[model samples]
Target: MAGPSRFVVHVPFTAPDRAEARQYARMLARVLGRLPEVDPAEATVSPEDDQSVHSRLFCDRLLSGGHRCALRAEHEAPCAVVESDR
Candidate 1:
């Protein structure tokens, strides 16, 4: 069987620091994820200087119904999907 289709989109922007960059990535993912074709859980951030080194912004744990964890990576709480109420 064919594996899942995958593609990469690079969105470059300026950030004061790594921490701020991560914050921006998360925000972007959440916004883009609203689209049916987008998978926010798979979003990752990397510095322009070292594009090879990627840091995940979400927990991305496999969850029920084939969904992935929406919490930030390494989050202390149990993995869960993004609530619509948010």
Candidate 2:
């Protein structure tokens, strides 16, 4: 079988506090986990990039939040495959 693909999700953030990055990452992980194609247990979220769209979405969703999500589906699949393999 073909290997799973690798993708990148740019979670954007602006003028966020130090904790904001990790918080946004966690929130993003939860949201991404909800995706139909995503495996909740296998799903992983991290500071993939600075000033990313996902980070911005997290921030934007809340009154004080200003994180905007930029998830690219195909890239993250490999991680799921890797997680499952382990």
Tell me, by lDDT, which candidate is best.
1
Worst 10 residues of 1 by lDDT: 77-86
Clashing pairs for model 1 are none
lDDT of 1 by residue, 1-86 (tens): 99689798998999999999999999999998888778788899999989999999999888999877889988999899877433
TM-score computed on alpha carbons, candidate 2:
0.38
RMSD of each candidate relative to the true structure: 2.8, 14.7
> Could you tell me how far off, in angstroms, the CA of residue 25 lies in candidate 1 after the best superposition?
0.3
After superposing candidate 2, which stretches have Cα over 4 Å from the reference? 39-86
For each predicted model, how many residue pairs clash, with residues at least 3 apart or on different chains?
0, 29
For model 1, the stretches where C-alpha displacement exceeds 4 angstroms are 1-5, 84-86
Residue range with the least summed lDDT across 10 consecutive positions in model 2: 55-64
TM-scores of all predicted structures: 0.82, 0.38
Report the lDDT tens digits of candidate 2 across residue range 15-58: 36646655555556656666656533333344535333222222
